[model samples]
Target: MRCWCGKGNDTSVKTVGVCVRKDRVSPASSTGVLLNNAGFDYNVTRDRQSAIIMFCHQLNLSVMINANNPDDVLSGQNVTLDSRDIYLFSPYLVTNGRFSSLTDWQQKAVKCFNKTIELGIKVACQATSNSTIAATFNMTDLFSQAWYGTAMYNFDYFQATDIDLSGMTNVVYYFPNLNMNYGTTWQTPNVQTNALSTHYYRQTDTNTLHVFGDGLAYGNGTLTQP
Candidate 1:
């Protein structure tokens, strides 16, 4: 049977309510028993001292117990213990889960972002008007630039003309409707099919006319007023 200290064998015994010592046992043997019984299977090496310290700390062992014996405690080494090592050496410290490194955390974040993007696309497809698109945008507002940019680009295809450019002073044409084809050459109002489209007539600091289509376009006096 396993002892209370978590050691595999029953040869070692605990005394005085502390597992630090056994009946007439050497300090090294006692320390080994304490570590093994406590479920630590790592070797006591100079490089693993900090891990040992973390393990002991998790068990709430007295610091004096660490300092009393020099042979059991390896020295002359510096090593930083990360979450992975902490979990590996002493799993009781990690209640949530374990991440091996920063890369692991980043991968998890990417996975979550992908799921959010998938949901946002579904929301965008069902959006019928400016208000619905705005509401859908709010849902993906916290996503990264890449995800939101793609969402905005795809959303333009569905309701490009419904976008509200009320506060935009530089915007000359918010396009009365989404009839303009993507990547097609800009046409003059006289030759264009959609001539009745309400074109915004405004004078700005520059002659630049902003057209919001599949992608933004800029030109000087190309879009004329009816």
Candidate 2:
């Protein structure tokens, strides 16, 4: 399930099946009546979580990180999260977790494909994909591709504990956004970028996925990007 976003390298982005009711496919769009796509209060955090879990069950799934490996949905571009990606103020989101310092940056986040039904493909194949589901995550959440679980700037910042790197290919890491101030102390770890067979990134318009450099979209023909 891939989409061609319009950007450098097409700046491809894959979105999730679950999303706010506003993005829902109205029943009027086709033959079926609107079911869960509307009348659900998705903006509420608690309802959002419960709705996701319920949708997951409907999709025949029970876990978030379904597997330990990346689906490699897009080109594994080496992204460096910097000031451009982060801001002093937070967005209007309720976070499940957070990483304030380097101590919490000594792990690896693997690939996950939890309820990632590509709506574009479904729409193309079928009339439309009514079984809607979507949820946004904080960058600090281990599940976020934006999360720097595996050191982003300095691998030596934290000591590794029981680790497993048995099955990984062409692993890439992110460079952190640094502020070389005169009297500021900054020590961040390298963030190992993991793959996600999801469209919840980079682009969101007309269901077109754009893939490209650093931020992630596509590579000439990466297994996932193509």
Choose the strongest candidate by lDDT. Answer: 1
Give the TM-score (vs. native) of candidate 2.
Answer: 0.17
TM-scores of all models? 0.15, 0.17
Worst 10 residues of 1 by lDDT: 86-95
lDDT tens string, model 1, 154-188?
Answer: 22221221123223333322323222323232232
Candidate 2, 1-226: lDDT as tens digits: 1111111221111222422122454435422211121111222122333343344344333322111112211113321111111101111011112212121111212111111121111100000011221122111222222222211221112111111211132222332322112122222221222354222222111221221122223211011211
The runs of at least 3 residues in candidate 1 whose Cα sits more than 4 Å from the true structure, single-residue gaps closed, are 1-43, 63-74, 79-226
Superposed Cα deviation of residue 72, candidate 1 (Å) = 6.4
Model 1 misses residue 206 by how many Å? Answer: 98
